[model samples]
Target chain A: MMIRLHRSPSSSMARLIGQPDLCSVSNWTSRENQLHNRSSRATEQLVALCKWLEMRMTKLIAGTTISLDGFTADAKGSPAALYADFAELQQSEAMQHAYRTTGAVIMGRRSFDMAEDPDSYAEDYEFRTPLIIVTAKPPAKHPKEGNGVSIIFATSGVADAVRQAKQAAGDRDVTCVGGGMLIQSLLRESLVDELQIDIAPVILGSGLRLFENVDQRKLKLTSATSLAGGRTSLVYEPL
Target chain B: MMIRLHRSPSSSMARLIGQPDLCSVSNWTSRENQLHNRSSRATEQLVALCKWLEMRMTKLIAGTTISLDGFTADAKGSPAALYADFAELQQSEAMQHAYRTTGAVIMGRRSFDMAEDPDSYAEDYEFRTPLIIVTAKPPAKHPKEGNGVSIIFATSGVADAVRQAKQAAGDRDVTCVGGGMLIQSLLRESLVDELQIDIAPVILGSGLRLFENVDQRKLKLTSATSLAGGRTSLVYEPL
Candidate 1:
């Protein structure tokens, strides 16, 4: 179902959340209407806002492999260990459909530097979409590559990086690629809208946690499907 | 799907995970063959194992209200806030069916002590089932009460509490009530079979974490469904 955000922030609960600072919710939040307290009165606005955001913003949706313990990667930052469980999911039609909705990819600098393998840019991976890297020292701004994918670096931060990626995505969605820390920053800043995670059924006793130190926020599950090969695909909106 | 534990631990990747500490796999592990690497070879084992446990183990499941941030309660340990989101879910048929499967209820000392209401021991909540509590100090070693639910205390740790609870449960499942610390111990000890958390779509920015300081382990999701009143019911088995 397409979720829309209700802008009726007139309830006392709405008033409680309408502080100027919070009122100035990011374009990501304002566009996606990701604010939700889910309390009796507050939940109404949340539901309304969720509906609005669902339609307004080019959703910053993320597709990643997350372990049951909620780690996106191992302690050494390698993603292959746990993510390999969903190799088939990465190549599935559902995944292809998800990627087809993406106009651009936003990722941390580390992911940018590490995404050198030609196969990693396959249609199964990201379809050679335009890439915007959130970095302190972005590499030389390159226009579209031979694959027709534009690669740009945003030295500014998450918001600016997302803005550029959103513009680049046109009417499609922006995919946030991760390296944990940067993902945490985007989530903390509430720049993300939907999370499409393929949960691998393996546990690495310890690793860089997927939701590490990210601010506490409740998510409304839009869908949870048991995919082929034991991987679980979960789609959620931050309420 | 009936998940069976495929005992093909001969994969090179399986060898990587077949270490001695993990190999002293509990009778629970051996009985259920609770192990999975999720490599091409072992992923089959994980799939099989997840199904087996789902069917075999009269799981010691937890049915608690948790916030989106993975907290079971507030920092002060009060669970009134986010938990209220599931007032309707508590009265759900799904919840009632889940409770009907309960043979016993295991909880921490705090919960036992704080459960001053007569209704907490009701057929709906615990159905006056056998209540096994883990604590250093055993309250009075009471037998079955007038409510037909036996109330017992285990001064020992998680294993003993689970063992006793299992014995009392016989053919039924055990419900572990959470206060965070004890549940962490159970999860850390790898004694918990299934977690049925009703995630309230609300954020408590600061509170005691649901799985605070617990060991990191991947959980295989058995099922996830949106319950009544917007709460999401998630059932997972920790690997």
Candidate 2:
């Protein structure tokens, strides 16, 4: 028999498992509630199945533009040189795919702070999704939230931040925007599902490298495309 | 009136400028020698013109396979991981072009030493051309060279080695087959004309980076191609 899920199975499973309300599943019908109460053993089995499906559906992708030499930013944490081809990179097919698939973003505090005005992201950012900022402490005042964008401060750790972001993402992807340190931590923990690297045609002799201190991993190239303005987009997944 | 050069103008120009016999220009016709003896002033002008043409024609290309994270070799100076896509990389159009156009090679001593047997290069290496090894001192014994391959030890330093390689290359390109240190030195001196990087799908985490300690330079992407076995070939020239 075919089972029709009115809401995302994972969301319903989370509610039945007594997890925090990570997603909105409040519109459950009386029939579904009756079914949930019918068999505890069957519900547990369904929870395991949904959890497996959720793990497969929600991906965490680390996406960033780096220099030819693999640096994400210059010594002073500026990515000015690396973004010369930003306009073209933004128009690339891979980037468009990232934008369409991303439902949440996780970034380090430094990356968030690098923005001249965090409030601008509410309306101007490409991914108008929930933004989870990982930091040791949340700031005193939060940015004004609107346009379906919410700023969340995760002080627990990167792992917790990833969990929250994945929940917010639902079936979509959680993209890790960077300051190098954040991406490195995620890579070290093997939390990243895919790496979308746009290699700019500039060499920064000394800078903040993207892969510094990350665990060694063998990656299989998924796609390589030449973008406009001499930018190459390379997609890889850990093997 | 059109002036045709029977021999390479640079060869004739080098002789006119009283430089070392860098190339074999002995096949100069008597008429050409009479022209070389005819006017010192005209010969001086031709030397300057040929020098400009030579500078424009002969390019120095630094080519190597690097990991996605920019490491040319692992900590032990082994590129085993990087060469996983070598068979396809060698068949790539860019690599084929490199092979077709390269007439001489310059390498560091460490790279030379890495070869189990130096004499095997004559039979096994792709480029059956002159090999110039840059070192502080030449070895007491020389490898048995044949099959149009001659090994020269350049105790005079990298710059002098480059000069010798370029002279030997004649109208073709001089390629630097490296260990990272040699490529870095060439980059520091702004001598590399093109960077032919074959990015393999791997992250070394810690290793010898290809662009380490080099001068910061802006490059324009010439071409980016995806090769067999998930390898990416990117060609760049300094802007």
Candidate 3:
């Protein structure tokens, strides 16, 4: 039996528009992030229509490393250790498969600004596929020429950004790559299908909580694997 | 090398005084929940002195089953299935030994009120040993004469409550039985030496968070064991 997933009108998912092969991926340049010809109202309507037409079973998975005290990032917006122990996960065959199969990445604007430009790293980032950033404003920095990454800014809302990301992901899973308000909204509106939490053995004391103001949700534990260095990854699907 | 154990003066730990062996295991009676001759002030001062003399090394271990969303109990004051999945843990020889060796149990007042009295169960409760409760107000109901468990109320504060609980525990480990405001204070003061968190698959979206207002502390993961009911227990010692 084929499963058909229809757009959950419950979530006003935004319409995702890829920022045209923006700046040539070579020299660092600054371009004012602005919407050129897209009409806001028309885009929202188009996104709704596209969502109605695109009835595919793509899962929007939210993944993040949260502290034992339940913090993903600090108040100042710096993530707790960023990718410190994440490297250990790279050695896991299952983790490697996840990275290879992840079709696209969606993050909040804060994550985009905090993350180093993929071009500067020399090596392509694992999330270099396609990046959709959800923010009211665009970052001052632009991708350099030659970087194998595409950027899309969703000014509309989370629902729009998620819809755009799911459509872009096709049948593969779309990973929500940030914490804070973005994921909070995702939890609030139930736009996410799966949650993969990497529990780090530290308490940031007082930072942003991963789950706040969200209703109780009973999740089914599909998998749990312990990573070296006191970190464990837990995968869950809504029951 | 033999290490010296000492009660922490910094915490102003309380003195544990057991109620007279009341009733020979069969009957109902009503007594005002007041410490007849014990004055709060005298108890505090005596606690300080006893801890100074006792100087015995007793570890206070906090254990609670937390949901994916970090709630240990619901808003209605009921525990997340009060040790429902804990039965699997009973199979572990080490766990059984620990339960047998445990000298006392400490819990917040709410947990005490919410739990079924051991007497009502018509059998010995797993935590049939000495029980210490920390609450601002005394519970209205007292154990019917036949219940074998003993009770001590710590009204002064958490520091005093834990001190009393530790002293009663003797050389054995004292289990801080629930996750609530009392444990939060213990975490704040860095009083807990070891934390054993059982991660339950259920996510209670809006009840009570297990940890709140806690400062950042790095914890060393000592052990991780999976339970049969899809629950995983992670043990950590504060670094």
TM-scores, chain B, all models? 0.70, 0.80, 0.69
Docking class of 3: acceptable
Give the candidate number with the greatest lDDT. Answer: 2
Per-candidate iRMS values, in order, are 3.5, 0.8, 1.3
lDDT of 3 at A227: 79
Question: Model 3 off-target regions past 4 Å?
Answer: A1-57, A81-95, A116-124, A137-142, A145-147, B1-57, B80-98, B116-124, B135-148, B155-160
User: Model 1, A1-239: lDDT tens per residue?
Assistant: 23344423223433454434444434545434544332345655665554344335577886677665456777777777665555576688787887777778888878767857523453334556788878898555443364647667798878888878877775577888677677778778887788776666665556666665666676777876776655666677876
lDDT of 2 at B53: 67
Candidate 2, residue A73: CA error in Å?
Answer: 1.3
| DockQ class, candidate 2 | medium
Residue-by-residue lDDT tens digits, candidate 2, A1-239: 11223335565665667443354547878886676556556666777777657755688889888999988888877899988877776787767888898889999999898878888888788878999999998888888788878999999998899989988887677999886899889888888888889898899888888888875689889988887888888999877
TM-score of model 2 vs. true structure: 0.82
Q: Write the per-residue lDDT of candidate 3 for residues A71-122, one digit (tens) a residue.
A: 8876675674534666776777767877776777899877666656634522
After superposition, candidate 1 runs with Cα above 4 Å error = A1-56, A116-125, A140-144, A216-218, B1-58, B63-65, B116-125, B140-144, B203-205, B212-220
- The two-chain DockQ for each candidate, comma-separated, is 0.23, 0.69, 0.46
- The lDDT for every candidate, in the order shown, is 0.66, 0.81, 0.70
